[model samples]
Structure formats: structure tokens, C-alpha cells
Target: MTRVKQQKPAASPAPAPSIPAIPKPDVPARLAALPGLPIGELKAEWRRLFATEPPPYNRRFLESRLAYRIQELAYGGLRPETIARLDALGEQFDGRNITFRRIRHEQRPIAGTRLIREYQGVEHVVTVTRDGYEWQGRPYRSLSAIARAITGTRWNGWTFFGIRPRSGA
Candidate 1:
């Protein structure tokens, strides 16, 4: 007959250190007044927050950006690495030196042009309109949105529809 000894149970883990909480900032009052603000006041507010000349954007653009800046200051901005990656991606698509204004002003396809792609046995069609793209008689902000609707997943509309070549093709 063999005798067995009882083993001791393992010890419990130490308590984790508590992290300090970051206090949220109050919402800027300017955000509420944005809709009615004139372009000059918006520009001045942009200068006050950013400490630089405001980009030559319209009133609505200035208001939205200033609102974002206020929130960004209260919270924090994207990490440096994230911003770097975004910059690299923009450079990959366009040149590193390319400005957004140049891209926005670039010519678009003629208003009457149509894009067609067949997926899952259904032919999807999109039309280029003066302001944006249209699909199935509904206006869309981007082809990606229409592609998502068709594929039930996110996709780069231009690449999915063959407007732009596939990565290797």
C-alpha cells in the first residue's frame, strides 16, 4: 500500500493598480452658436484655437473643424503613430506633397457617365452626377457606400467595380 501526500492550493493573484481617471471637458458654447455664426467670426475663432491662419474653407467647414479642435484639446488627438500612418496612406494614394485643395479641385468624370459591376449574379449600376454619384435612383456620397450595400461588407467602391485596377492587376 502506497501513502499519498496532499498538495497545497495556489495563492491568489495580487490586486491590479487603479488608474487615474481623465475628466471630460465641458462642451464649447460656440458649438451651439455655430449654425448662425458668420464666416468672419468663424475664421476668428479658428485663429484663436489653432493659433494659425484658417484654411480658406466655407463657414460650415470652419465651424465643424473648430468644434472638433475644441473637443480634441479637451480630450486628446490621435497618437503620433496613427497620424503618421494616415499621412503615409495619403502620400501612397497621391504624392506626399499633394495638397487636399488640389485633389478636391481635380476634374471628375462627366455628369452622364455610368459605372457597372456584376457581383453575386446581380449587375450593380452607378451614375456620376454633378454633385455626387447615384445608384438605384438614390444619391450616394461615395461609391464605397453603394458597394457596401451590394456586398454586405465594406469595400473600396472604385476597386470593387473595376473603375480602378485591383492591387496587383
Candidate 2:
């Protein structure tokens, strides 16, 4: 019986070496390096982290947001309750809540604080009260009213008093 030579089974390929994962740097180290990174590098980082194109905002904005994002990723995002609370608060300001009235609480000067202004070489003092402002022994509902009383023309009370309006008001 002529038996055909049986071919030996091909040797299996050796398993590839397992490369160890490169450990991520600590959060603080990553954050500390943000300011020094070039803009291109920052954008690259943003793309890698967000998996999208970086915004067209300025460098400072990118840095600040990236810093926050880095920390957020390292730890965790806002709690669900906190996010819900923020969304509800946002709804109040976005005109979605029909009964919501914009309260100028932050715009109002603290009660009992004295505001002094000089117009036409005369010094005027106004006291901030809980309900309104007091000027020359008269309660005024708004600083504009007080300013109008001081200056014969309509003027922005904050501008007249050199009080810069709070940003994002």
C-alpha cells in the first residue's frame, strides 16, 4: 500500500506581545499643563477628549472649559439631582416658566449701604433700603428716579453713580 506522505500541520503563529497601557497622568498634572500647551495642542486635546471639533472660542475659553472637562472626566460629571436642579433653574430664566418673574435681587444694592455721588459740585447721598432707595429723605423706587431728581435729564442711574452694572444682568 503506497501511503501518501501526510503533511505536518503548520505551526501556529506566536501570540503577539501584549503592550501595557500607558497610564494616564494625574488630574492636577494634566490641568497644570493646559496653560502651557500650544493652541494647536489644546485643540487636539479638546478633539480627543470631546470626540468633536473644538469650538471657535478664544484661548482662555478653551483653556477654562478644557480644565473643567479634564476634571469632570477624571472624577465624574455633575450629579443627576444637581443637573435636574440646574435645568429647572434655567427654565425659570429662559421664559419657559409662565409665572416666572425676573427678580433683580442681585441688581439691588444691599440694604443699609450708602451710595454717594457728586453732581454739579454738590455731594448727594442715597441710602439703600429694603423696599427702595432713600435720597434727601424721600423713598425712591429706583436709582434712575433718584438720578433724574439729581440731574434735570433722564440718565442711567448706574452710569450716573459710576456703578458698573453687574455682568450678565
For each candidate, give its TM-score against the true structure.
0.41, 0.46
**What is the per-residue lDDT of model 1 for residues 1-169, given as tens digits with 9 covering 90 to 100?**
9989888898888765432222454555646777777788888777777767899877778878987877776688899999999988877765553332232324445677898888989898899886668999999867778999999999987678776432432
Candidate 1 ranges beyond 4 A from true positions:
1-23, 95-169
Best by TM-score: 2
Report clash pairs, candidate 2. Answer: none
lDDT of 2 by residue, 1-169 (tens): 8999999999999875432222246787988999999999999988877767899999999999988888777777799999999988877664563212333657666899899998899999999887778999999877888999998889977788887657887
Off by over 4 Å in 2: 1-25, 97-163, 167-169
Please give the clash total of every predicted structure, in order: 0, 0
Model 1 score (lDDT): 0.72
Model 2: weakest 10-residue lDDT segment is 94-103
C-alpha lDDT of all candidate models, in order? 0.72, 0.80
Candidate 1: worst-modelled 10 consecutive residues by lDDT: 97-106
